[model samples]
Target: MTDKVLALVTGASRGIGRAVAERLARTGHKVIGTATSESGAAAIREALQAIDPANDGIVLNIADAAQTAEALKAFLDQHGTPEVVVNNAGITRDNLFLRMSDEEWEAVINTNLSGVFRVCKAMVKPMLKQKSGAIVNVSSIIGTTGNAGQANYAAAKAGLEGFTRSLAQEVASRNITVNCVAPGFIKTDMTDVLPEAQKEAILATVPCKRLGQAEEIAAAVAFLASSDAKYITGQTIHVNGGMNMG
Candidate 1:
């Protein structure tokens, strides 16, 4: 196993997660990315192998606590404790709060908000012992600015930011920094698959004409993961192109 710092990207099968995994591998980090399924794992392996065959990949459903614990243990048993952890796994169930089913809210909260709690809890001991670590959560613009039909997703993400702040303080003395990155509309398979008219409507709300590239977010992750960002913690770096800046 490469001794360079290991970075884990959850939901790394595609989109921002995939891009971050590949970029980290290229930057010489031992990238161990997670997929929710076998096919997704294979895609991650192929993508990483193309960059560096030594790269690592695994399948994980963060919402499953037992599986999550086992996967993290196996990942470390093979690669090692992560020096950088990106909580990028997420899902969206858009509906008016009044109409949103309990399952929808529970699923989103469990995976996006509660899921991070699970994964981070598992990593805390390892990171604390290491005396250093970095966490970057993938939040959403809707988290800060409530959306019409994404109450569940927005609540989960907003909670994630608060979680980041609380966790950052808890680990600050250990030399670990925790932060979040809220991406605006990013062009990816996830977004590309959206209806064209829907895409146009989103663009109208964004001040910039173009959507963000996955690389842009990856770059932000890389920066925060590096020593250069040692002074920055408990902060949310929004990559939205002038959309809802606070």
Candidate 2:
């Protein structure tokens, strides 16, 4: 067995997920990142392997419950239980509530909220037997503040936070910590395409007067997953640039 801590990070092909995987690997964790496709997984593998040959990647679609369960079981059988699990896979189907199709709401809720439930259910037993672990679910500031055209996304993220708290209570006795990291407007592909005027408008609301980097969110996740945060559980650490300080 490797001396390094084992960590599983989902949706690690790009953006916040990619940064989280890299940060954990650089911090001495043996990371196994997941992407939805073979090509994306290959990219994650290539990137992480450069940091540590023990690090690897696999294809996992959290939207599929059976596949998630089966894949996680096989992964645990092969790599043992991970000390850390980061649920970062999420999709956005932005539409006004009046215009939003059932598909839009279901897709976001299924992937963002229920998908985390599936992953947690699969891993919680192993983590209980191990008796120590950290789970960081990536939420969004919009979940709290709400946003136009993001009703489904907001509802899913809000539900995720509630789920985090409930699960944390259930597992705290086992020394398993479940927490959330709610990021405000971060600089990613999603934000990069915004009109320059819109981008400026967003920055104006941020006290930092700038967009956050993916690495910044990664740092918070790294801390929550570290031994230093062993006593912390059922908490939501907001990583916005003073955008929403509620």
After superposition, candidate 2 runs with Cα above 4 Å error: none
lDDT for each residue of candidate 1 in 170-235, tens digit (9 for 90 to 100) = 999999999999999999987888998998989898898779999999998888888899989999
Error of 2 at 194 (Å): 1.3
TM-score, every prediction: 0.97, 0.99
Best by TM-score: 2
What is candidate 1's CA lDDT for residue 59? 91
Candidate 2 residue-wise lDDT, 66-174, digit = tens: 8998899899989999999999999999999999999999999999999999999999999999999999999999999999999999999999999999999999999
The weakest ten consecutive residues by lDDT in model 2 span: 65-74
Provide the overall lDDT of each model, using Cα atoms, as 2-decimal numbers: 0.89, 0.96
Deviation (Å) of 89 in candidate 1: 0.7
